[model samples]
Structures are given as C-alpha cells and as structure tokens.
Target: MNEQQRTILAIASRVMSYPSESSAEEREHIDEAVDENIESADIRKHLRAALAPLDALSTRDIQEIYVSTFDLKSKTGMYLTAHEFGDSPKRGAAMIKLQKIINEAGFERTEGELTDYIPMLFEFMAVSPEDAHHERLQRRLANVGQRMLNHLEEENPYYPFFTLVMTKVFPNPTDEEVARLERDREEADLEELPYPIMYQ
Candidate 1:
C-alpha cells in the first residue's frame, strides 16, 4: 500500500481499538485524520458523522456504550472468525491459521488479545509490507469485514469507523456474497457458544 493508505489504516486501527477511560485523545486523533483528507470523500463523511456524537460523550460514557454495543450484544462481535465459526473446531482452526500468518509477518499478539480482533488486523495491515501474504490475509479479512459491517448498526458510533476501515482494505462484496454473509451470520448466531471476554 501507499503512504496515504498506510496512514489511514493506522488511524482506523486506533479508532477501532478498545478505549481506556481517556477517549478525548482518541477523538482528537480521529478528528485530525478527518482533516488530513487522506481518506476518500465517502469515508471522510462517515468518519465525521461517526465522531460527532462520540465527541460529546465523556470517556466513561463512551466505554459504557462500547461495552453495551459489542460486549452485551452478540451480533456486533469484534472477533472475525467468531462470527463465522463460533466456538466450533473450525473457528479454532481459523484462529490458528491467522496466528500463523501474523507470526510469519513478524507480528506478535498482545498479551490477551486474539489474532482475529479487527483493530489488530488493521494494525497488521498498516505495517506489513505488501506481498502475497498480505494480499491473502487481506482477502480473508475482507470477507469477515463485510459481514461485520452488515451486522453492525449503522447509527452506532463504530459503524462508520468500521465501514471506513473495511472499505480501505477490502473491495465491496457482490450481491451473492452479501446474501451468503447474511446467511452465515444468522447460522452463527444460532450456535450456543461462549462469549469472548475482552482483555482488560
């Protein structure tokens, strides 16, 4: 990827990360990214719209909202494979493959964070040199990313952020792919799986 693409991916990684109590700094960073004009017009618009409400909320409030949205709600999960494979053996296999790719790219997993976390995937994309490995991983992530956007509520603060991030790394899915993703999401939801606990 080019410099501008790398920059935007880095910004998106931060925006999608789990925020601590100090979210004002994160919001400022996002605002600055929006001003940079590195992203396309649609992405810029969505980024601005997503941040507007978040800018007004306190750090605690933002944390609560995030927890309620992603944690309390199963539909908006952060783990890419979880949405597809749930807690089945297939999900474990997928996670292992992702971890292998991350390791091959010289990326280490954070203490308790999973390889499938979207922000970490973005971070990986931002720094890894463009090559066959990156391209293959990007394709895999794009599939999951499309499904993520489909499941997320459009009005949620993180929705536009995800949309902007996914669009940057992945091509928009076709109509048939969209239909398949919808079906996959529904099937995944029906499985009795343990919820993933976020690293504190």
Candidate 2:
C-alpha cells in the first residue's frame, strides 16, 4: 500500500472500530484519522454514488460496494462467488420453508484467506461485539476478505475505483450523460433538481 492507502486504511480501521457510544476522545481519534491524514473521502463518495441506482441489491451488491471501494482483487485459482440474487433483497424467518434456493453463497473461505483480514476482524471485535455474528456483517466480511487479499497490490489509493460501476459513471453513455447533467444542475444549485439526488 502507498502512503495514502495506508492512511486511508488507518481511517477505515478507525471507522470500523468506532464505538456506537463513542466518547469525545474516540470521536477525536476518528476525525484525526479521517480529516487530518486520510484521503479516502473520494473513495467513500464513489461508493455511495455507485449504490444509488444499483436497486440496493442485498448481499452481493452490498459486498460489491466494500470490495470495490477497498480494491479487493481476486487471486488466480481463488474465486469469490455468490448465489445469484438478480433483483431482490429480502429477509424472512421463523423456520421459513426453503424455496429451492439459498439466499447467498459466501466467497472463497480458507485458512490462508483468514490471514488477509484476521487483524481487521480483531479490530472489529473491539468495536462491534454485537455484530460479530450478524448476517449482514458476515456478508460484508467477504468484501473485507477481498480487501486483505489485494492490500499488498493496492499501490494507488484511488485505483480501487476501477472495481465500481456507478450508474452515472458506468460504461453506458446515457447513464454517464444523465449523471453529468445532474451534477451540473446540482452545482448550479438549481431549485428543481432533475436527478433529485444528493451525490456523494
């Protein structure tokens, strides 16, 4: 990792480790990690922007957000795959009957893979002892796992953007055009915003 990536990771570590009931000193530490040293605002910005038109896909899309934001590149022979949930994100319980479908499959999990994020896991334990077993938290770990895998190769802090597909910045020109126009209107502070979104 470069200086800035390291700095941003430090910020991420702080954010991930932030207490729900954080103290003044803890808040100050987080602010210092992000405002004073970290340059990852754009990274967070791009991620929020990317999720806007994604239809808020549950497991995979959310995991994609972290993976892309943190630039987790897969290694050869080490595949990260998920059960295909094309258009919906849902939750049901109370011995819900199986619908001939699994909700989502986890990424490649192995002994070696654990090393990529064990420290982060430890840090997270310090922060959210409750979330240690939450399903959402568990799914997001796939992203963190990918981050650990690629942390060594992430030479440029912003290069992680390549993994994203913001509807506005995505390949389709129409989407890009729409995003650009929306940006212009927002910049102008127009009273009636067409896109109606507050871009990150």
Candidate 3:
C-alpha cells in the first residue's frame, strides 16, 4: 500500500478500536494527517463524515457505544471469524493462521483480543512489511466485513468507516466467495446446539 492508504488504515484501526482518554487528541492528529496528505475528494469526504460524530462524543460515550454495538451484539461482533465460524474449531484454526501471518509481519494482537478482530486486521495491513499478502487477506475477510455492515444500523457512527474499509481498502470479493459465506452462515444456524460447547 501507498503512504496515504497506510495512514488511512492506521487511523481507521485506532478509530474503530475501544476509545480512550487520548482519543480526542488522536483524532485531531488524524484530521491534520487527512488535510496534509489525503488528496482524493471522495475518500476525504467519507472519512470526515465518519469521524465527525465520533469526534463529538466523549471517550466514555464512545466506549459504551463500542461495547454495546460490538460486544453485546453477537451479529455485530468485531471478531471477523466469529461471524463466519462461530465458536467452531475452524474459527480457532483460522485465527491461529492469521496470528502466524501477523507475527511473521512483526505485528501482534492486543491482549484479550482475537487475531481476527477487524481493527487488528487493519492495523496489521497498515504496517506489515510484506505487501504481497495484504490483498489476499483483505479479500478473505471481505465477506465477514460485509456481514458486519449488514448487521450495523446505517446511522451508526462507525457505519461509514466500515463502508470505507470494505469499499476502499479491501478488494471486492467474488460472487462465489460471497455465496459460500452465506451457505456457511446457514449451515451454522442449522447446527446450533442447545448449549455452548468447547470447539463448537
């Protein structure tokens, strides 16, 4: 990725993560970066619209929204693999491979977060030394990302930010790939057990 793309991904990763007291200052820095480097009018406009409401909210409010939106809602969970694999062994295996890829690129997941967390994916792509695998990973996660967008309310502050990631950062996944995820979702729904068990 180019410098502008990297900057945008880094900003998105931070913005999408749980908010902190420093979030306001970090947002200000993001705005300055956008003004200085982001030349595309469409990207600039969409990014600003995405960040505007987030900027207005206090850190605590944003934290509440983040938790309620992602943590509380199973359908809107931030772990991309969860949407596809639920608690299945497939999910664990996929995460292990993802962690290996991230580690190979000199990036590591934050404590208590899964390897396939959406923001971590963005953060990894932003600074990963190897560009060869970025597009491959983006395409792989595009379906899960789209499912997340589908679950989120259109007016949610993070909606447009995700739209930007899906449309701009990740290349469009093939129709077959999308259909496969749909089938997986259906199968997982049919296989839902009465109670949660290890490895699903």
Candidate 4:
C-alpha cells in the first residue's frame, strides 16, 4: 500500500475503535493525516464527515452511539468472525487462526480486544508487510467488511470510514463475489445458533 492508503487505514482503525475521553487528540491527528496524505477530495470530504460528530459530541455521547451501533447489534459487531460463524466453535477456530497471523506479523493485539476485531485487523494491515498471507487475510476481511457495510445505514457517520478502508484493502471486488458473500452471510446467520449447547 502507498503512504495515503497506510495513513488512512491507521486512522480508520483508531476512529472505529471504542471512543474515549482522549479522542480529541486522535481527531486532530486524523485531520492532519487527511490534509497531508489523502489526495482525493471526495474521500477527504467523506472522511471528515465521518469524524465531524466526534468533534461536536462529548466522549460519552460518542460512547453511547458506539455501544448502540456495534455492541448492542450482533450483526454490526466489529468481531468479523461472528458474522460468519456466530457463536460456533468455527468462530473460535477462525479467531485462533487470525491471532496466529497477527503474531507472525509481529502486530501486538490490543488489550481486551479480539484479534478478529475490525480495528485490530485494520491496525495490523496498516503496518504489516504485504505478502501472500497478507493478501489472503485481506480477502477474508474484505468479505466480512462488505457484509458489515451492507448492515450499516449509509447515513451512519462511520459508513464512509468503513467504505474508505475497505476500498483500500479490496480495491476491485467482482460482482459475483459480492453476491456470494451476501448469500453466505445470510445462510450463516440463519444456520448458526445464537447460543450453542455444550456437554462434557
């Protein structure tokens, strides 16, 4: 990825993470990154739009919106594997695989956050070297990111941020692939149980 792409991915990762009182500093950095790195006026416009509320709203207000948008709604959760596997053992396996990839790339996991969290993955991709493993992982994340985008309302402030990030990771996904991901996401949502039973 180029400098602009890398800069935006890093910015998106932080902006999409849970909001904190200290986020004003982050917003300043985001503005600077846009001004310095982002060349496209359209993308700059959308990114600034996505972040405008952060500048206006208190941290608690942003936190409440964050919790409602991603935490309360399982379909819109940042944990990407949950969209594909729900609460299944398959989700656990996928997370383990993702953790291994993060370890191999030497990207440290955020405390109290799963490796498959969208922000965690974005942070990893921003700094990690591009390789076969990276490409494969990007494809997997692209699938989940697209589904999350489909779930989100276009008017949601974060929607443009996600669109920008996914655009960089999966620049030109085919129509057939998009259809396939939507179909699979629907099937997974239907077939996977919300709470699995376990026995010893």
How many backbone clashes does every candidate have? 0, 0, 0, 0
Off by over 4 Å in 2: 18-20, 39-200
Compared with the true structure, all predictions reach lDDT values of 0.71, 0.33, 0.78, 0.76
TM values, all candidates = 0.78, 0.25, 0.84, 0.82
Per-residue lDDT of 1-200 in model 2, one digit per residue for the tens? 23444444344343322123343355467555546654567754654343233323344544444454332332211111211111113212211211111122222322353222332432332233233253333333334333333443443332242234111111233445334323432122231224336776
Q: What lDDT score goes with residue 45 in model 2?
A: 68
| Reference-based TM-score, model 1 | 0.78
The numbered model that scores best in lDDT is 3
lDDT of 3 by residue, 64-161 (tens): 89888877776777777777777577888888888888888776688988788888888887887646677777676777787778888987878878
Q: Which runs in model 4 stand beyond 4 Å of their true positions?
A: 40-42, 175-200
Best by the TM-score measure: 3
Considering lDDT, where higher is better, how would the candidates rank from best to worst?
Answer: 3, 4, 1, 2
Candidate 1 per-residue lDDT over residues 1-200, each given as its tens digit: 67566767777677667777656767677677666845567766766775567677677877887777766655576787776665567778878988998898787977788888877887788899889988866776677778667777887877766776677657666777656655654354543245566885
Q: Which stretches of candidate 3 lie over 4 Å from their true place?
A: 130-132, 185-200
Among all windows of 10 consecutive residues in model 3, the one with the lowest summed lDDT is 186-195
Error of 1 at 22 (Å): 2.9
Better of 1 and 3 by lDDT: 3
Select the stronger candidate by lDDT from 1 and 2: 1
Q: Which sequence of candidate numbers ranks them by TM-score, best first?
A: 3, 4, 1, 2
Cα lDDT of candidate 3 equals 0.78
